[model samples]
Target: MNATDRTPADLLRSALAADPARPLVTFYDDATGERVELSVATFANWVAKTANLLQGELSAEPGDRLALLLPAHWQTAVWLLACSSVGVTAEIGGDPAGADLVVAGPDRLDEGLACSGERIALSLAPLGRRFPAAPAGYADYAVEVPSQGDRFAPFVPVDPDSRALVVDGVELTEAQLVERARADAEALGLGPGARLLSGRPYDSWEGVSAGLYAPLAAGGSVVLCRNLDLLDADGLAKRVESERVTRTAE
Candidate 1:
């Protein structure tokens, strides 16, 4: 990316321009033995589709609050960017009762149902399959997202200075989000094409920085690992060697 990039979406656009074919986010679920890798173009497509789903189907608008009740998985990362693309404020672990919409994992089905607005349930299953049956009062994300347009254009332009994210009571404008991410990238010594292996959840500032924003700001890639506690040190070392990881953050 560049110093001028303001939002997470801006960082993504830069990454798409710089290396569309390079792997952007590689995911690993140690307990489930699941591995998925998305190139910039592929990740962009997922973001576009999910953004369409949010805007067109859920009627999500700029400044709308989205409660992200999900684990640190690849799909959760996609949802975060999709919210940013549509100019929605991503609220990490926010209360469903206060949110305009809720995108939830299986474990949070009850919390999702409590939300009066739109609710989308992710199977978080392999290949992003739909739940056997939709959760009560919730749309199955895997079912609805496939038919949406592959290209996304926001109905309203996102303002870089507008509130874009809220994590654990801390609100940040898009510009601030990018600025902190870039600073974190520098602190981590990330350079162009750097590959990072991050075993952190996105519930806090440091985890979000390491797992998502930092890599984008630095023009790098991330290998995001969930259930990392299950991986032995030797196994993780082997993965780092094979994935050519340039840096690591726990």
Candidate 2:
């Protein structure tokens, strides 16, 4: 909660402590006709449960690599933070073959099977449903996550100087991640209580900063839109107004 705090999970804990009822992430998937809003409390609950699943079930340790084979959706966001909570390094679009764990979306199920360690598949449905039947050689994320405790405590202390994220050929430590996020927030003109509407995909640093890290660092919220290209400019503008978006990153 202090200015020196750097880990993403710690930052999120600060956000929840500061304003648990405030909207943290408002997600819209135009392609799927889905919309979901999560307050800090709800988002943290999801993160905690997912973290517990990663640590308690999978035995994730600090500095472990977690390949995130997911798109820019609410569940993917949860997985990213959950990794931070458990001190695992989240590698966006990284190769599963080298990972300690792989969390894949429906489209990546086949690819995920080739992963080295533990594997979990997400249907990425409206409510994070599991596959009709558990995938071969993989755990069902939705089925397992809900059974995890709502609170999570890491088995070992997470080092702020340790690698926390890797994206677009760049690896960042937990402290560096927070530092970059805070800088990106300032660059985007984000401030306390600001709400950002972002249509950027999560594969790049800019997109990840805008959609997740920056807002969290700035004490702001985000409205993350997938398939945003399908929306006309007028419609996008209207949603921004309706959502009270203070900034927009496209």
Candidate 3:
């Protein structure tokens, strides 16, 4: 990570500036035999559009709480960074009733409806497809996000010391989050050019760190695997070799 990076968004910007073409996130759904690779620039575009949606359409402001009820998928990673860029405090598996906004996948739509504020639902389909019909009282993310500008600039600048994330009952400011991610990267032995394969779900701080933040803070990339347990030992080994993964996070 850059020494001057003060927030997770800064880390992503540094990565993009360093090598926009380099792969940043490689996602796999072993159960469905789906694989997707995103370059730093491509991922940044998604973050930009999503951030625009949050800031402009959803009216998300700094310090507003957003309950994020999504699984460990590529779109989840995008939303994490988008929240960072918008200065919204992302609460993983948090109570929707108390949030200013809620983003949920198909399975969690019922729970997400508890939030009275803006709600967005994701299909989480193979290619980020929209739901056949919008969920009641919720905007369809896949449809709304695409029309947003590819470049995003928040109306209000994010404060480095503002609360940025809440996971597992722990609240962390943007600076603290970046610091912890850097430390976690070092502890995991991830460095520049390292490729980490992670099978952890996004239900805890450890899972979030290992799956996204650590690799990002280390100027490395991650191979995020969903339903990884479904893969056999030999299949796992072959995947490791094929993806050139340097480390494994269970």
Give the Cα-based TM-score of candidate 1 against the true structure: 0.98
What is candidate 1's lDDT per residue for 1-250, written digit by digit as tens? 8778888998998889888999989999988899999999999999999999999999999999999999888898899889989899999899999999999999988977778899999989987889999988899998999999989999998899988889877899999999998999999999889999999998988888899889888989999999998998899899999999999998
Clashing pairs in 2: none
Instruction: Report per-prediction Cα RMSD to one decimal.
Output: 0.8, 0.9, 0.7
lDDT of 2 by residue, 34-100 (tens): 9999999999999999999999999999989999999999999899999998899999998999999
TM-score of each: 0.98, 0.98, 0.99
Clashes of each: 0, 0, 0
- Residue 167 lDDT (model 3): 92
If the candidates were sorted by their lDDT against the true structure, best first, what order would they fall in?
A: 3, 2, 1
Taken over the whole model, the C-alpha lDDT of each candidate is 0.91, 0.92, 0.95
Span of ten consecutive residues with least summed lDDT in model 3:
1-10
Better of 1 and 2 by lDDT: 2
Off by over 4 Å in 2: none
- Tell me the deviation in Å of residue 182 in model 2: 0.3
The model with the greatest lDDT is 3
lDDT of 3 by residue, 1-250 (tens): 6798999999999999999999999999988888999999999999999999999999999999999999999999999999999999999999999999999999999999999999999998888889999999899998899999999898998999999999998889999999999999999999999999999999998999999999999999999999999999999999999999999997
